[model samples]
Target: MLHLRVVCPQGRTADVTGVLRDEPGVAHLVVHPGVAVHPAGDLVEADVARECADDLLGRLADLGIDHDGGITLEQLDTVLSDRADAAEEAAPGDGADAVVWDELINRTGEESRLSLSFLTFLTIACLLAAIGAVTDSPVTVVGAMVLGPEFGPMAAVAVGLVLRRRDLVTRGAVALAAGFPLAMLVTALATLLFDAAGWLTADALDALDQVDFIYEVGPFSLLVALLAGAAGMLSLTSAKSSVLVGVFISVTTVPAAAFASVAAIEGRWSEAGQSVLQLGVNVVGVVVAAALVLLLARSRSRRRGADRALSDG
Candidate 1:
């Protein structure tokens, strides 16, 4: 369930309340009249079923509530009221399966931003993978995979493409374009420093065979990326963090970037090229698969909504 709070103008409170009262998926509706200071109208709140969130919001949008006031949504972990249960029962699908488009886009938009934390995490993950490549440490490589933050922006890119949100697509692409190269450059410089210290060298890399898969791009690589990407987007839309963690660990993108940087630092141009190719293949597979999954999910949602509307009429 979602908790929706609306700040309405003095003149439009009735229209906002009417929509809230009419939505079958709403429960525990509350209206505090003349309470809003900034918007200067009324404060209205409701508990809404997840399956009906988008439809309810759309109706409110049609009323121009979005422009005249503000709407805020929050997910409720537990709704103890019988009315809440009834509203959920009245909804068409499981709350866990519902995709609140606004929520999804907002979340991706924030995560896809080109921020300091993003660059820091990506660079650290890449450096860890580079260390793993030089020392042939599978555990470290796996750790790098789990730590990589590349999926968020790429997921945003896919979501933006499917939803036709140009801002999201551009921001996501710019983040990726700038983030990866910066991380790789940092990782390469770190690798060079380590090599100069005689801690790890090209010979150590030569002896490292366990992490070779990072540079090995094959059909299975794309297949795995496709599967992981689909699962990742599903996890995000469904609010399943456990499933998302598995998705993070399933791809070789971070490892490939790390290995490519380390290989170039050691003057192994051929392996670096192969690692670059592997990274590209994985990225393409993920974005394409994620977009396809979102497209299918949206289509299904529209059909289900149409059918429900017809039945309601």
Candidate 2:
């Protein structure tokens, strides 16, 4: 379930209340007239079933409440009331299967922002990957993938395409465009330092180990990328955070970038090109797969809603 706290102009309270009251998925409604000080409006609160959240939020948006006021949603980890159960039962679909687009968008928006902290994490992750690549350590490659912060922008792109939000698309693209190149440049510079320090020798760079896969983009890479993309999208929408960690560890974006950086520095132009191709394949595959999954989920949700409406009528 989700808890929604709304602040709306005094005149719109009736409209807001009516919308909430009419929805079978909403319960424990409370209204506090003229209670919102900063927004200078009435405060309304309710428990909403997740299955109905997207539609309910859309209705609220149609009222221009978002522009004139505010709405915030919080997940109710433990709702002890029978009322909450009733709300869930009254909703058309299963709560666990619901998209809860507002929550999804908000979460990804925060995650996808290109902040200094994000850049720092990306840089550090790429550096680790570069070291791992030069050493041909599969364990270190996996660690670098886990540490990378590239998934946020990938998810943002998916959500942007799903919602037709150009701002999100632009922001996501900008983040990727800036973040990857920055990570690559930093990794390259760090590789030079490692080479100068004699820690990364030509023999180490040419080691016949896991690093070979990083620079060998092939059909198998495409297949793996497609699978990872689907799983990543499922993890995000289903709130399966543990599964998301697995998804992060399974992708090759970080390793590919790092491998490309190190390979270029070592004058392995062909290997660098292949590594870049691997990165591009994974990124493109992920975005395309994620967008498709979201679209399909939303379509199913809408169909279920339509069926419920017909039955009710």
Candidate 3:
């Protein structure tokens, strides 16, 4: 639920009130006449009955209503009692689970289209990772991982699945599939240039040859991917954006790809293949984990509605 506040010019209060009265998801309408400050006529407060705050905001914007006013959930609950029945009636049932599949596909498509910023960040990340691999410095490798913007698409894919948005899934998948190859090609070119400068060392080549971790993919990596995916999604969905910085470091997608590029440049074919596999594993793991998390969040929301209905009954 969302609380919406509207401030309108004095004469226009009635017009705004009339508009909101007909909106489907709005409840707890209150009109405070003669509430004025400089350039303001009246203040209106209300609660939205739906969970989709973005959709609600769009509707309000279409009505030409200034939504900068603040409303509190507690105040809304105290003012409105009639919406309880309506909210209960709108609750979902078990069959709503199918929406998850649809959302996954939709999100994938949305993530596929790369923005200019995304491309720029990815290129820099791949370059950093390649450098890190050549230097055999874990710190630089982690820095490259943190710099990569791949999680945006991964998180979008998860959100699409949870929201049952087929378009998002397609976009996300396209972005992920395209992004890696682009990063790989650029990194490969950079690696070759670096190697030509005689900067590639034997130790770096040996580091790439150590392929034990790639084949050892098991529950630990999966768990880390899952946690990182969940954190990434939460950061995207919530106001707490700083947390996503850590999430970028927790996943191995960029680092592994960098390793692969470095290995290829040094003529370590077997190790390059292993690094490729590691990158693939991380990508798949994060996507799958994010999908699951979104599914769970949606299910929990549905269950809350059901429980509220039972209590009201």
Greater TM-score among 1 and 3 belongs to 1
Model 2: per-residue lDDT, tens digit, 1-313?
8899989999999999999999999999999999999879999999999888888898899999999999988878889989889989988877767887877888788888999998999888888888777777788888899999888898998999989988788888888899999999998898889889988765666665666888788898888877888888887777776787888887889989988898888888888999999999999988988898998998998798789679879
Q: Please give the CA lDDT of all the candidate structures.
A: 0.90, 0.87, 0.66
Backbone clashes in candidate 3 total 35
Tens digits of per-residue lDDT for model 3, 1-313: 4466776677666767776675655666788886857445678887754343333444455656544332222213343466844642453332222122222333444445687777778888988977776665667777888888888777766666766766666667777787788888899888878768878754556554333343235677778887887776655444345888898888888877777777777777877887787777788788887777667766775675578559759
lDDT of 1: 0.90
**Stretches > 4 Å off in candidate 3:** 1-113, 201-203, 207-219, 310-313
Q: Please, what is the TM-score per model? A: 0.97, 0.94, 0.67
Instruction: Give lDDT for model 2.
Output: 0.87
**Which candidate ranks first by lDDT, i.e. highest?**
1
| Error at 74, model 1, angstroms | 0.6
Across residues 1-313, which tens digit of lDDT does each residue of candidate 1 receive?
8999998887888888898888788999999999999868899999999998988888888988888889999989888999999998987878888888888999999999999999999999999998887878899999999998999999999999999999999999999899999999999889878978888777777787798899988899999999999999998898786897888888999999988988998888989999999999988899999999999889988998899889879
Clashes of each: 0, 0, 35
Error of 3 at 107 (Å): 11
At residue 195, what lDDT does model 2 achieve?
85
